[model samples]
Target: MYPLNLPPAQILQLSSQLLCSGLALLLVGLAAAYGLEKQLNVPTLVLAHSLTLIGPSVLKIGYVLRLVAQQRLKDETCAHAIA
Candidate 1:
């Protein structure tokens, strides 16, 4: 929501990369969480791990949608520039 005023192309590129990174991190975190839950069986660790996994998943989905929007904006920009 903060306006960095980056061009749509940059936003799309950066957000796409960030989205991928976020997903990779989410997978790793989930794996760790699974291990901790199964091996340690601690309730506090379970809650913390769940929150960590969930927050990033939300952020990753947001970035994916942001990238899509930025790509659409870039396409429209190109169209207008051409016409």
Candidate 2:
């Protein structure tokens, strides 16, 4: 049997922790935006909420692209070594 080199359950647990933390951060951001809306106005609140929603997505895309690049480099190295 080919050994499956997946991350262990503990890593999954840690990931769940990170997910929860992200959710908490999103909630806090929304609350802050709400407070700002009351203090300032609707436009500022919209900007804050948009940033809060988009920022993490942008970060995740960057991380995924980096991983893809690393994997491509490794594949090229392996092909060169084989040839």
Specify the highest-lDDT model's number.
1
In candidate 1, clashing pairs total 0
TM-score for each candidate, following the candidate numbering: 0.53, 0.54
Q: lDDT (0-100) at residue 13 of candidate 1?
A: 67
Tens-place lDDT per residue, model 2, 1-83, is: 21223333433444455555556656766776876667857777777687578656644544444454455557668999999
Q: Which lDDT value does model 2 have at 50?
A: 76
Candidate 2 clashing pairs, residues 3+ apart or interchain: none
The parts of candidate 1 lying over 4 Å away from their true place are 36-51, 54-58, 61-83
lDDT of 2: 0.58
Worst 10 residues of 2 by lDDT: 1-10
- Alpha-carbon error at 31 in model 2, in Å? 11
**Prediction RMSDs, each to the true structure:** 4.0, 9.4
> Could you tell me the TM-score of candidate 2?
0.54
